[model samples]
Target: MTEQQQEETTADQLFATIGEQADNESYDENKVVNEIESLCMNCEENGTTKLLLTVIPFFKEVILMSFECPHCGLKNSEIQSAGQIQEKACRYKLRVNSKTDMDRQIVKSEYCVSKFPELDLEIPAQRGQLTTVEGLLGNVLEDIAIGQDVRQTEQPEAYQRIQDFIEKGKKMIEGDAFPFTIIVDDISGNSWIEPKPADAQNVWSRVEYLRSPAQNARLNLGNPEAPNVDDIQPDEVHTFPASCPSCARPCDTHMKLVDIPHFKEVIIMSTACDDCGYKSNEVKTGGQIPPKGRKITLKVDDADDLALDILKSESCALTVPELALDLHPGTLGGRFTTIEGLLAQVYDELYGRVYSGNNDSREPEENKKWETFLGNLTLAREGKKDFTLILDDPLAGSYLQNPYAPDDNPNMTSEEYERTEEQNEDWGLNDMVTSGYEEDETPAVIEAPDFPAGAPAA
Candidate 1:
């Protein structure tokens, strides 16, 4: 047998062993179990440690571990993510006001820091946990009360302050503290808060930001040594070792620089995992951002228009006025695909978000509205409906194929305009001083331009 076949067979045998040890014939297909004896932290005695590897629906795989020490009657449990670190760090904020909000599920990875802004309490990175908002608060209370008895005798003032804080936490868990915010920031981007139902008004918000160099180093996700630029040929694909985002298994990523016929050069990157059969690809524009933003509007008159190739950069916002579809920037990331394929992706993203096994929770009116919107999107994807497609890119890195080539396509129009101050700030271009820093004694301040009354605000 080949080396790859041998590896697969070994993996199968290992899983079989784990299944036999678990001794459950009706275990879920997405779950595997194993057990071992480990030294207990409390008693220093051997304790049974059970590990369950399971995949969360709509999310990724995670390992759940539970330990029981018979000698000390101690028990503990924790959760660890099995997926690779994401490209950017994530922060989730949720305002808890009702009982249901306290019951919201939370996935706290080892690198996650949770904060209760109103209570002035912060829980730094510790053991990973899969719990609810109320359970998290309970754990915090337990941790804080550990040495309170000793402190009450030795340091009465400090002990009283902690007792008051613990009382507030208990009230918050009991729903007495009605409105407060819980923030979970994960540098590894593996933590998440359960999203609200489609029909419910959600008070949760999430933001993703680039990690600083120090944060990356702390997470052990720092950049590798830089490669020599001269070694990479423009036409040749360069392959490098990387981890699969889905399975966290070792894989290879291929990248190549390609030039479009009528446009500038771009870097194409692709990754495929042999173990999980997961694949992903993206396009990155080469060189610097353009000085002026671009707006492209296309009138899709027939099926032929849906076959045109398009490049939508990460900074582009797509809109379909007729279909009432407006996708903000960074919605689908960068993509080099045909119009039909892009529309299909948009349909899938929206459909999955609204109808991911929560049909019973949706109101009739909301359900019907979403159904109609999805139906129209499906028709547009199949080229059975005519609609207007608009691409607004502040970086001017997006492109739509002109079927007529040298001659302008009558159905399409393109224009360039100066970017607004807000757009520049969003792209981090305002702080970028390319030259004259050494000779300048002071920095220059830029003032915003005043516009007429009816003009749109930036």
Candidate 2:
């Protein structure tokens, strides 16, 4: 066929499939379209399956599907993420204390496991869903009710126990059980819980952690076997096959050990995901913890101080009194960056967390306070304001550059002090018996009571 005829034939085929010509300009990406008719699993009848390809405003692309059977009146719905997997597994914990909290939106991925600690109930990983808290509980109730009638007849005791649990779940869904906890753990890191202003407090918490090797293997990204560190040399950068945390695609992680002039040796590791353009670098200090903790204080009065390099270990606690910034250990992990870049990161982190969601829900006074704090932080980050930067590390692994080479900077001071018992416990050092653990593990012997034996014999 001619080129024009071929194009016409393709257009005709498209029109025949859809039964109409598609609108080009007025297309809605979120609109659900009938994709196909498939056999219904329940009734063996044909069911209409509709599909929606859209991107979540706060997240990424996801495919929503629904199936309905006219003959059997069967209906089903599910959601699947079309985006790449996140770099870290995520867990969301929410304290449901009111009706508003119950209405919170939840995106539960197929790899997510939800738990209700208060009710001692756990929902294992299943089909992905976009639902509210109450809706999820209602679905659980319906599932529990499915085999209940038969159980009531065959296993009366078990039926009563399950019925009681069902009643409790119903109460929770009905808002009678006001105060409870819901935890969503998603290894794929695609699930999400809607955040409210209450989340800024203890009512809600979200934590992201590195996935275990088993989890990576389950995802089918790469081999779960760990790389041999013995082959890694300090002078050469070792590259290993790995999976990208963001995309779950095959990637490489590069690691090298570098010795600082005045400081100790540290491992520098970096990972770049070509599929998603996600790059990350972290420093790992490898050495015995110092006997004493070190605290470094720098008065940033001159803009030149911001150009100084800094090494903030994972165990370092950073503080800026002037900016009212106090960050605990493990806040930003380990970093080797200039003072300006670090401050900028600190500003960005605080800004993002403070204003992550809607700010109109916050009180005017509280909003104003946060705005002022951010403004001061911005000024400090730009080196336009004076602030005192303090790095307190229990391991004494942190470092700040001294422009005076052999001499200490006039504006900087370093002090070492004994770590407190609480600090040791926090670091898990209190339980560490490096040298005499074998002696401590030896079982103690006990002799029988001779006097008691004699009395029994008499």
Report, for every candidate in turn, its global Cα lDDT versus the true structure.
0.77, 0.75
For each candidate, give its TM-score against the true structure. 0.68, 0.65
Report the CA-based lDDT of candidate 1 relative to the real structure.
0.77
lDDT by residue (186-271, candidate 1, tens digit) is 88989987654231212665545567656777887756334435655689999999888655689999999998766887889999
Candidate 2: where are CA atoms >4 Å away? 1-34, 145-160, 170-179, 196-201, 224-231, 240-253, 261-264, 271-280, 289-308, 313-333, 346-377, 383-458
In the range 1-458, model 2's lDDT, one tens digit per residue, is: 76655764653332221212123214743223657889999999898998765444334456778999999999989999876777667677788989988888789999999989888888999999989899888888899888999999999999999999999998998888889888888889799876652233246656555676678777775675555347456778998888875556799999998887668889899999876677888887776788999999999999999999999987777878787666656557788999999987777766756664334434597678878878887888787999999999989999999899788789999999999876676566765657755677663322211110000000
Model 2 scores a C-alpha lDDT of 0.75
Locate the minimum summed-lDDT window of 10 residues in model 2. 449-458
How many clashes does each candidate structure show, in the order listed? 0, 1
In TM-score terms, candidate 1 sits at 0.68
For all predictions, the C-alpha RMSD in Å is 7.7, 12.2
| Residue 19 local lDDT, model 2 | 14
